[model samples]
Target: MASIRISCLLMGLLTVFLGTEVHSYAASFGSLAHTASATATTTTRSVTTTTRVVRKRTWATQSSNKAFNINMLDMCHRYGYNVDGQFVVPEFMKLLNALNRAQCHMASEILYPRDYCLSIKDEDKVDLIVIGSGTAGSLLAAKLSDNRDLKVLLLEAGNLPLMTSEIPGLWADSIGTEMDWKYFAVADETFGQSLDGKKVNVIRGKCLGGTTAMNNMLYDRGLEKDYLYLESIGLTKWGWKYALKLYKKSEDCKFEKITTSKTVKNFHSQGGKVSVDSFRNTRTLGIRQSFSKAISSSNLKTVDYFDVKNHRGFVSSIAMIKNGLRLNAARAFLTDANRKYNLRVALKSTAKRLLFEDNKVVGVEFENSIGELIKVRVTEGVVLSAGPIGSPQLLLQSGIGPKSLLNSLAIPEVAVNERVGSNLQAHASFLGMIVSFETQPLKAYSISEMVYEYLLKQSGPLANIGLSSFTGFIDVNEDGTPDVQIHFYYYSEDDTVFMPSQLDAFNFNDNITEQIIDINENNDMEIVGISLLHPTNSGNVIIEKTDNGYKPVIKYGSLHEDDVTTLLKAIEWFKKVLTSEAFEKYGPKIVPLKIAGGPEPNVDSEEYWKYAIKHLTTMNVQMAGTCSIALNPSEGVVNQNLKVFGVENLWVADSSVIPRIFSTESSAPTLFVAEKANDIIKNQLGCKGSNESNEDDDENENN
Candidate 1:
């Protein structure tokens, strides 16, 4: 009877121990089986007895193992754990210790037993390979991949957009982060000098969707005359007729009560991939109505910005946003149908250089995600869609630019195109005026409340990009074409609650900051900015050899006298609108301009405005015209067909090939260029279902 009691006591103790172990395991990880089974086998020898206990754990699903394994590998790499193709106990213990130090609780190390450092082999050959999956490249890839007989490979230098990119109002937060190239231009004596005496930051998106992913979602198809000017300069194929068709083909405009004007109904297409709409249906914060009344008081009529026929009045700005989310180029063009079959996308792959065999383009060599060089062979051709600066830099790096530049850089010249990186242009803008209001609409709610509204209903102050609500185009030249674009938006002193880094991102000087602080200490403010649409000055983008790799040297040329003259006229026009009767209701007050270490200028003098222009002028990030199209190599880098001069099977289809700068944002025009390029490439390849005339077929028929 005493022996039986001792056995019962031992069993009770074992049960408590098992319960404690199971509880600890569950607490460290997630939910698991409530009971774990353990079997003990005992063997009695001459002098000793041995027992082996086997424990069984049941996982929720196979996907759980995969998820845990991925997390473990990520944690091991992040914490510097030595994972040399094996999952040993010491290495696992090191990972656990690091996780513990980081205050992270993880499941058992046995869950992730596979090696995570194994190499993956990708497809090496395709009919066509396009480098840089940006605004143009994404659409081009989708169109080219539509033909199942063709295999297309697209490579992007950056990864997919983060969750921050999906939020419409958090665009500025993405800039200068990993998603941006973060290029800085070489300071010019005329317009490049900022208040800090530093070069202006050239923010270019380095992600799959490119700049469209981070830009203020304005959906303006620049002035029609902008395209007509291109045709006048010898690019006859890029006339407004062709551009209009391409714009309609790509846009799916959703008209609502506020957006359904006669001009919008006639111009907007309904069945396209891209969704275009107005934020008035979502959130305008009453700024639209106030601005409309203000402009009207100054005798400026409110017209549709998309009228295409008229661009010289106030209009509600449209955006490339739908359902309160940013409709980026990737979402518009890179559909699942394209990826499911013939299209292959390589993200986080940097194109090192183009591969050539005796002047015939063959393949591309790029650095993959693992930092290993991978070569992708192209059977037909290779298209360079790496934007304005990147496209020129890649061409120069591949020995395809000017002979002199290539010789100086110790790169053998394959093509001597001197204009490969010349003629860079960007719109220059200046803050016209800042007006303080007694009370603002956006200041009514806290940032958390705005975010909550957006999360629940996808509508609120968070849905509006704070750049502008009402835009105005004016013909400073008086030559029938609008040469100045004005953007109007409200700026609450408390807006920093929503975007903490806004003031820093604005790159304001100390004097401007002090003025802003003084104004915000009392009341909210609104700002209006004017951009010179038709600047006569241009710039150039060159490459320099660096210790790490090739770096682009952007030279923004001196601002011309005419550019400043036009801005002066624009500022005068803005003053009239600011003092109109419409602002009387809001009791608007202008914040005086002050310069650091200098006397305050007379507000009405051109001299003072010029000082402000020099200190305040900045690029609106609408850079273009680097690798422009022309009749020959002497005049431009590529011909009207977008084929690189003196090179076969090489093409470029991006904003770089634009012959002239547009009077508005370049996103829509860039998309049009890519669509046109699709036709050009299809015709050249004689692919099935091509609507273009194939020269090869013509030759065959003649033979």
Candidate 2:
């Protein structure tokens, strides 16, 4: 009878103690058992207290052991333990891997002037018009708007930032909503195509923050030579010096508080504006050793490049974060202080066409907040930040494109038919493999009692941006210049590079998206992603079929042999990465990996693979090149300052105007155009930059 009573007590107690998807405070045998006890003995020197002992005992019931093994990301990363920037080190990639996706869904939607700021639009009037509220635009707008007289009109087509945006796991939600300007790429012969040719989607934020709000927030500036290439291609002012200024202007780097390089510590500012560090308590010894071996074997060095101009090494990734949250463009530009003044932010409104008088740009026609059609006449000037895809379409609708294409659309030929909408570029990204292992998910924070800490203490997993970190750079070409860049992001759960039906399943939003994740059911898992930059194949953006208005038709021109080579090279590299010692031992099994020793999946060969990849490959959605720049006005569509040739008071300051494409996030460069173009326009007008222009400024106004 006594034995039976003891067994009943043990059964009742075991049931009471269980670990949840998130940590639970209730005392249970899981932690007091094998794994937890072993970790405790090693981590905690000598046991002191006895009154509240761990209740050490190996339970006969296997249920608790099974539950304890579920989704251990919180426990594994040591989340809910640190304060003032203390965290775990080895599993940083796990955190970064989770950040690979851009989440477009919001728990709740906020209203703005346009459907969302997924695409860029011109706020192009002189000292005021702010183009793109993403990383750079927001900072510029907020700081510039500081001038009392400048009645800034901050425009974004995307939804405002939400509380959930601060949560790292739901990152993919940044891509789909009203904010994403889902531009499709023109189809090519490489990928499997529809009888009706398929275009890969190029998404941009139509919201105030622009892409910065949606991006993973890894701060990477490619090789210095990329800028020099710009000078060779028609952008003389965009050389290093000019580019450096913009970088300085946009960042208030806070390296002291971050777990990164001294160069980053010294070069970047913390107090200036955008909060830039989320890699605290990460960067473990295990991770460092693994990456060092992996990158080194690949013949790459690990060095700090943030402070130096020309750097090479595997440096820790920098971020634009604040208290473990993203400091997006809107946060920088659209401030509460500015909103109090005449700075009006209109959301959900898309600029349709530029209203013109003969050869002069007069104002802009647009669909308002409720999708109402309206016209805003700018007696001063009109700026075009409609990005690469939308801006060109806008110009064409406003009568500014190639004469041949315009004649085909039957739109009245307005601006002298120039080379607008020519050079389109972007990066191609692929999911690697989904890992299901006895591993932690990437949020991997290191704190004691993490869940409760985030819930009440306001310190824990919630305070960390989920990501595994980032790396890769422009590969050296035979000419001794780096030409392409790539990044490998490791996560605890993803399938970035699978087969066709698998690719569709991973890349698109299907019924799987509707199914909520049961974190409790998943543990010992990981995910990997690899991205290829500097795509060679150029595409075209034409006006969609319409008697009036300009809806764009995009083609994913990915047939260039050079692009095929780059994609294949990057894929091969990822295949090699999966075999590294650390991963081979602890990482999930990589099946059918195309590396040296792997079981054969179904198909092989360039022709078969090209067909597979072409149909499989899609743009990272970093779209650019439509209204290209030219040193000689006759050589390109827009002039050096991105002004449409022979047009009066009209300019395009977005990716579309970039004459040549560089390999990095395109938004940063696009914002730089807005920055420099604003100054150039002011100089041309000979006006002291301000919203209310001087009498002399009137002459410079387009009309």
- Please give the RMSD to the true structure for each candidate, in Å: 17.4, 13.7
TM values, all candidates: 0.79, 0.71
- Local accuracy of candidate 1 as per-residue lDDT tens digits, 1-703: 2223323322332233222222332132223213233343311111122433222221211122332222545434443322243434464455345433322111110010111111324437788988877778988888888888888888888877654565676667677788889887887656534443446778788987888888878878787678778878878777766666677677888756324764445556777877888776334535556667777754557764555666778777788887777778887787563334677887778888888888888888887888888877889999999999999999999998878899999988888888989999888877636778865544354333443355445566667776464678887677877888887555555344322234334555544644554555456776667888867878899999998579999987677888888988888877777677766666776665776544475667788778777767777778888889999889998888889988889999999998778878888888888888988898889888776421222111100
Q: Which structure among the candidates has the greatest TM-score? A: 1
Give the per-residue lDDT of model 2 (tens digit) for 388-427: 7767877888777778887887878786555676667666
Clashes of each: 0, 104
Residue 302 alpha-carbon offset, candidate 2, angstroms:
2.8
Q: What are the Cα lDDT values of the candidates?
A: 0.68, 0.51
